[model samples]
Target: MRDPILEGALRRVRDEKARDRGRRGRLRAATSAALAAAVLAGGLHLGRHSLPAHRILVATTGSTRMTTTITPADGWVRLHAAVDGIDPGERCTLVVTDSHGRRYVAGGWVAARREHTDLDGAALVDPADLATISVVTVDGRTLVTTTA
Candidate 1:
């Protein structure tokens, strides 16, 4: 009986240690996954211009917001964005998505404060006709606006 009692105490201690070790392993894995997700998001934001061309809008209003606007069926579409607060060497990307979720990268560049870019693309779809439009910055800021 004394030997059996000693064996039980040692087994309980070993089980507790094993549980602690597994818990720590899971915590480390979760932290790593979260970090990987953040890195991927930042990388995607930087490469937003690699997609095909589509039209979008950048409101010249205060605290400039990007919105969708209609343009002539065959002409230039101007995009205005306020880079006053954007740091030097920073770039921005504007993207548009169709009803099928295919992405079109309309524009990407660096510019001075209160600048407008005249996007001269071939016969293009009007922005007001897009399913969704998104504007993203190099710092990973994004805004998605849907059309009627």
Candidate 2:
């Protein structure tokens, strides 16, 4: 019942639509690949140079293990520590003591207990002034201590 000319035109239009969908699919795949590559490159770059190279490991009396790392960046002494085996909701303070016995409280936080926790802060004194770095509980218990 359809005219020949109209049917031919409809077929051509459907073909064009199919071609557009294929083109779009290819473009979408390319865009996704490009985004994934960019993310991987950024992550590698950050992982390579973001932290310091020197680290000291210390074990706490509470059965927690910690590693202290010192990073000197932008004329600042950055003290960082990684701790594991902390109880969920437990509060702890990161303490930095200078050779002259001056104490600086970098920061404190409550553990989320996700198997490990990281704590970091900038020391007000020079890197050479650091004597001992320790993580202590609110009850004056030394969780971990490392001499600089």
Residue-wise C-alpha lDDT for candidate 2, range 42-95, written one tens digit per residue: 999988757455556565656788787787553346877888887888899988
lDDT of 1: 0.54
Which 10 consecutive residues of model 2 have the lowest summed lDDT? 51-60
* Clash number by candidate, in order: 0, 0
Q: What is the TM-score of each candidate against the true structure?
A: 0.37, 0.56
In model 2, what lDDT does residue 71 have?
Answer: 70
For candidate 1, the TM-score is: 0.37
Pairs that collide, model 2: none
Which ranges of candidate 1 are over 4 A from the true structure?
1-62, 72-88, 114-129, 138-140, 143-148
Residue-by-residue lDDT tens digits, candidate 1, 83-122:
3333445466666565566666667766455433333222
* Regions of model 2 farther than 4 Å from truth: 1-62, 73-76
Q: Highest TM-score: which candidate?
A: 2
